[model samples]
Target: MSVDVITNTSPVIWLGRVLSGLAIAFLLLDAVMKLVPIQPVIDTMQALGFNSTTTLARGLGILLLGCTVLYAIPKTALVGALLLTGYLGGAIAIQLRAGNPLFSHILFGGYIGIFLWAGLLMRNNQARALLFP
Candidate 1:
């Protein structure tokens, strides 16, 4: 005779998945907007004192896309998170330099960073072990 066993996933894991998905979706949209160089994106970049050139926007978009892809992959997620942290840090700096609002503009990147890392920590055992242990 043989016995069968079933395992159940924790709700926390599901929450993590949802959070990760939200972060990914937002980032992907932002990247696409940058890549396409719409008027609003160009206007925002200029407001932030960036060059607002199509080439620069496309370059940033490509970089964001690569980092987001890495984060989406389980194998390279840690590295991707680290890279994204840096990217978001730069964004925060830019927002601050531009004298944007504290809660809305400057902290927006912080909010996203929290979601990214929190999702990773909750969903990834390796990440939790590395950080906690």
Candidate 2:
């Protein structure tokens, strides 16, 4: 794309970066619950229906988050885009299941859109290099 087009997509770029952080924070929350093996953290995730599989959840969550963070960093942004985009997919699925048409749908949908845009932007040679490396 042209410089003008890329310049106008600043919001998308920012959203992608923020989403990377969010992914990290959320997964870290899960990771703390599982990897740390602390009762309190496990209790919390269990309360939220993340019981039994907390370890797997934690590992995947962290792996996904790490991917996004790496993507935000130079030379690894595309992988981050891949990770964040897929993570958002799972997020959208879970949020959709909650069945709150207003809050759940809008919030998750917006998040998905942002990540998708970021992923697409990251696909571009210019945007990818700028954001990732």
The residue-by-residue lDDT of candidate 2 on 93-123, one tens digit each, is 6555555465656376465546545554633
Candidate 2 regions with alpha-carbon error over 4 angstroms: 1-51, 104-106, 112-125, 128-133
Whole-model lDDT per candidate: 0.89, 0.57
Query: How would you encode candidate 1's per-residue C-alpha lDDT over 31-125 as one tens digit per residue?
Result: 99999999999999999998789999999999999999999999899999999999999999999999999999999999999999988887887
Best by lDDT: 1
- Tell me how far candidate 1 lies from the true structure as C-alpha RMSD in angstroms: 5.6
Candidate 2 matches the true fold with a TM-score of 0.53
Candidate 2 lDDT score at position 122: 36
Per-residue error for 69 in candidate 1, Å, reads 0.5
- lDDT for position 9 in model 1: 49
Q: In model 2, where is the ten-residue run with the lowest total lDDT?
A: 115-124
Which ten residues in a row are the worst by lDDT in model 1? 1-10
